[model samples]
Target: MIKFLVLCLIFLFLPFQAATRKQILIGEINHELKNLSALKIVVFKPTISEETEYASMVIQAFRNYFVKKLAFDLKDRENISIEVILITDKEGKGQIIEQKEDQGQGTVFFGKSKQEIKSSFFNKEGIQIYPTRSSSLKENLELPSLLEAQSDSVLFLLDFDNTIVLRDDQYRGQGEHLKPLEYKIKELLGISYPKILPEETSINIGDKAPNILLEGRKLSDYQGMILVLTFYPAAYSGIFDTSLITKRISEHHLSMMSCAMHITSFDGLSSKIGGLGVGYFAVSESTPEILANWKEVLETYHIQYINNPDYSLSKSFGSYNSNGYNKRVCVIIDKKGYDILPISIMINDYKLGKKKEIQEIVEKLMINI
Candidate 1:
């Protein structure tokens, strides 16, 4: 729950000195290993071009560095050379086997395919892998590349074909693959980082929502109100987040007919939307007190009578068909059954400027309605 922004400390560079900052940013890659343990990495060289050039780059960076430089950093220890393979469709599908256990490490691939750059830092050497051909992905493989990890084993997977990264713990990223190789490693390893775990990525509109939102709730009961869901992990302190953006929308009197108000789809139709409780190492937002607080935010925004939505992303809405979530996304579902992803923004995709784009979508919706 600690804000992951703390990782910025590592990137802050020298303050007030533009030249110093640039020097750090553009300077040569630091080859000195910073006491970080050498990792066992799998370099996924996909025979097919299913992954984007960037996704391929991420995989290669890991391979290039560990194979050449990482071992040198820990010369006293056995140099942990990376193993590589050009994963096939059948290989990606094996996450399909799905027997999940706990212990984990993450995956990294560093190198170049026709799609990726050869290398950047900590090393440029490549590890060659002999890959076995994969059989076709099966129709019943419900989950996308969902794989079980060996204790501390991190599976770095290239998608089934050439899509983006699938939503698997082992599938580190998607379309807007993390830049360079180093940062990708940071994010995947954040969970086990020495200082703090990284924040959960924002959930956006249009992407299939987590089932936790609709579990045990009945969507049939309330088929009348449109739902606006705001998602942040239980770890986020977004108490003021909904109120700020919603002030503009509230001015439009969105609650003219509903009996009550809600946000985060929180008050939409279920109490479970209150966010994970203390049991998950987070404070409970489901208590009546918290409900009152959420209601206050809704009221402040002039929203009313909208019970939390009871529809499961998969069951009620007929399956949460998420090609995959890009960045933090937010969606609007009209009660009459029009699903408008006017706010399909991926905050992580910086080039897309998704946050501003989402605001524009919201404004446009207000104008149209």
Candidate 2:
């Protein structure tokens, strides 16, 4: 009878012990972050083993959330830094086993924030807890406005079973749960969310190049020469550097055509090119602010500009995106006015800083020209 009573006591005490251990682990994580003053974003993943596939999914979700929803270029680490921590359970103790940095690429569509960015973790009950802030403190004192809380950093706690999965029986990582977390982070950063428009069908290889009006002439007018159409958001948007691309084109002596999403002046024409013209898609009915941002680029590279107030030109080529800007792509049209090179090939080559492949394609097409 005494043994039976002791067994019941042990079972009741087990849950309490587990809860205590969890709280201890949470304390340790918070202490670790407090010691690291430089880390702006910290992600904590707790696991029973070394495997971190679910943790990776969480990171990818954050990347997609920020890039797709907020338009934040995660690659701009100059303004933000992230650290991912892996906490492993060994013999009932939580230990931080690994740490690494991530770039999180995408551009900031809204204005940049000077506030320190942070992440929050969900508790066992799925309630988000900001580790740096005290829970007992008054709400106003604990949760200050984003601009007022410049020094505070957020931490994220991810558990494979509880935080990542929707059901205990399911294993897939659903990103829908991350929306609230993303909005909280955005609010903390003091940045407004911008509406993203839908993307249109893009131009494909072998399709006849759209005969859109370019200045006074049509796209077919350049049928005798191979045309390279490079589409970008705008000049110096930090999304893509058109100046570097133009320099590469000039060095390779490839005939080039550039497109933007705003009004631009095209007075400079380079004599070195087989053909050169800049086309722009208007963002609004009224003339948007003209920076003449590319005028220097034009004079320096001898590139010409053409204005197309119509967004159809961008849509026809599959360069239009929801951000009222052109998707970064380089489409190659053969001298016969048929798209000979896919945008993927050109974009991939440019990203790798290898213009040789594109130059080779242009040379081969020039043979037929």
Candidate 3:
């Protein structure tokens, strides 16, 4: 009996990778996420202070990235509404414009607050704080009263409403035109800023993570590992910059565990790429010559590439990289194999190159994670 008690205690204390998710569902004892496929999000139409094509692009880009790529079930409903109210000093109060979309069957979205698992994920609205041209308002540069958010516990974000409004409104005056507007994401979301939006898990600390692999190495092999997985599209013009990526990785002797996606355009401008395995890229249509340039890049940079399992897109494993957004950003995944997957995304500009920053972030993440 004493021996039996000791055995039971040992079993109880062991960190079972599959145990945390066990109680979530009967059949999904091994599944890390609990019915996350049914998340219903309402993307409120965005309001911009000064109307421009960029604002429209940002809004639509966010919406499509959420609904289509991230696989959220976004639909219009009467239960909640997030009306983007842009109080600009330009010329008008704000305009309400509606766009339509189809709803997909996505899973439940939830988050924990204080302690209890509460549904923090809700329909989103935005309030952009910008110093408009101010045909009537004050001329001296300052945060106008028109900039304060009118909130009823509504989730808000910094220039989440306007990415460039910061540049045009305040930064240009300050002479910081080319920086990403770093808003108080915490103040806006009332929480830590997510590299990826709608981080929908209750416990991430020690929960067993779902497997994310590249080439042939299974993530399970690194059960206790935390890696910085960067996704790059071979077709991006930036990928050709050998000094930026190849030289940096070689100098740092970083792990070469990466994957490349082949894109084939149905139309001359639109294309389809991978969503499967451990990757996502934002790309547009390109010719066979550009696709073949991966070899040239490898040879020139002396960068080694990993080969992944040949899988079909119909296998429900990959996604679409629309509008060349993949070329705009690099995905840095924190694959804590036996826990939640935390990501640190870095936007890449072919001109400015992210080598130094990427290397620093990777080293920091490697140490901390």
Candidate 4:
């Protein structure tokens, strides 16, 4: 896998850059989006209270939140707009702004001023509140009135209430709210950006398979029998059956047997490698430790493993938790202790083809070996 820092291609602002400058950074927003979505759609307090510090973190969180959600909807969204606002009140309880989604275009929102926010907050009489377009406030304020008073030129409203929280607030506000613009931008760009894939950290056809300690055992234990070493994420018992596993077996010769190794622990038990209704070997190390050992083996072959660990091995692996598991993978270890070939597979969700898949994998392994 290619590993290079994303060079921020900033077009130097000449004497006069474009009338408006647009800078974009792409990333995966899955983590941020999940975090935000899990929380109740309401106002959250900032850790920092100083005007600038509070504003900055709030803006970033908002950007991270919205951009992540937006990108999730449109995976191709690489850029988003982030605007900042500074509002003040006797009490600094932030107002919750509502969000609305565009038809695959992106998202937009409006920010409120100090007076506007205070009026809205009191009108609703709730500290944790989300403002809405039609919310009736003591000042007879409306969405347009709030938008007009915002300091920022443009803002992206996530419309969380409309999109997710489908309920009205008790009084002046709504339950779902819009995050700030900058936060939304980062999240959107992050979510839209594709994650880096994992690399194959195992030996291949022509390379020597490195020896290692496997649960107080050595990697050389299975040197003679055609070693079918499979690595799967622990929680994927459903999809890791015949088809996804066996499809890769078709490439090998007959006489080779396969074994499945789940890398994740079950119910906090000590890590054990199990296959064929038996415990092959169990390593107690955390996932990171196991991956480090795998990396050494791959690098010895002058090959780079895809670091994705999110999808197929593809001779590349990484710490990415794609599908909540390491990349679904399998490897053929030759009698002489060489990794003859590696195959990456993806298990479709809830597609109950496990029985057929397992059967096909075994047949393919028997035939190809």
Highest TM-score against the true fold, candidate? 2
Q: What would the per-residue lDDT of candidate 4 be over residues 336-366, giving only the tens digit for each residue?
A: 3244323222222212223245334434443
> Candidate 2: minimum summed lDDT over ten consecutive residues — where?
116-125
Q: Tell me how many clashing residue pairs each candidate has.
A: 36, 15, 16, 60
Misplaced by over 4 Å in model 3 are 1-51, 61-83, 87-102, 106-183, 187-190, 194-369
Cα lDDT tens digits, model 1, 245-354, are 35634575442211111233323222322121100001121222223333332332222222222112322222112321112223444333433222233232221123
Model 3 lDDT-worst window of ten: 171-180
Query: How far in Å is the alpha carbon of 311 misplaced in model 1?
Result: 38
> What order do candidates take by TM-score, descending?
2, 3, 1, 4
* Local distance difference test values of all predictions, in order: 0.28, 0.36, 0.28, 0.27
Cα lDDT of model 2 by residue, 266-285, tens digit:
11111323443322222211
lDDT of 4: 0.27
- Between prediction 2 and prediction 4, the one with superior lDDT is 2
Candidate 3 structure quality by residue, lDDT tens digits, 134-196: 432132222233333221111112132222121123211010111112122222333322132
Candidate 4: worst 10 consecutive residues by lDDT?
Answer: 170-179
Per-model TM-score versus the true fold: 0.24, 0.35, 0.25, 0.23
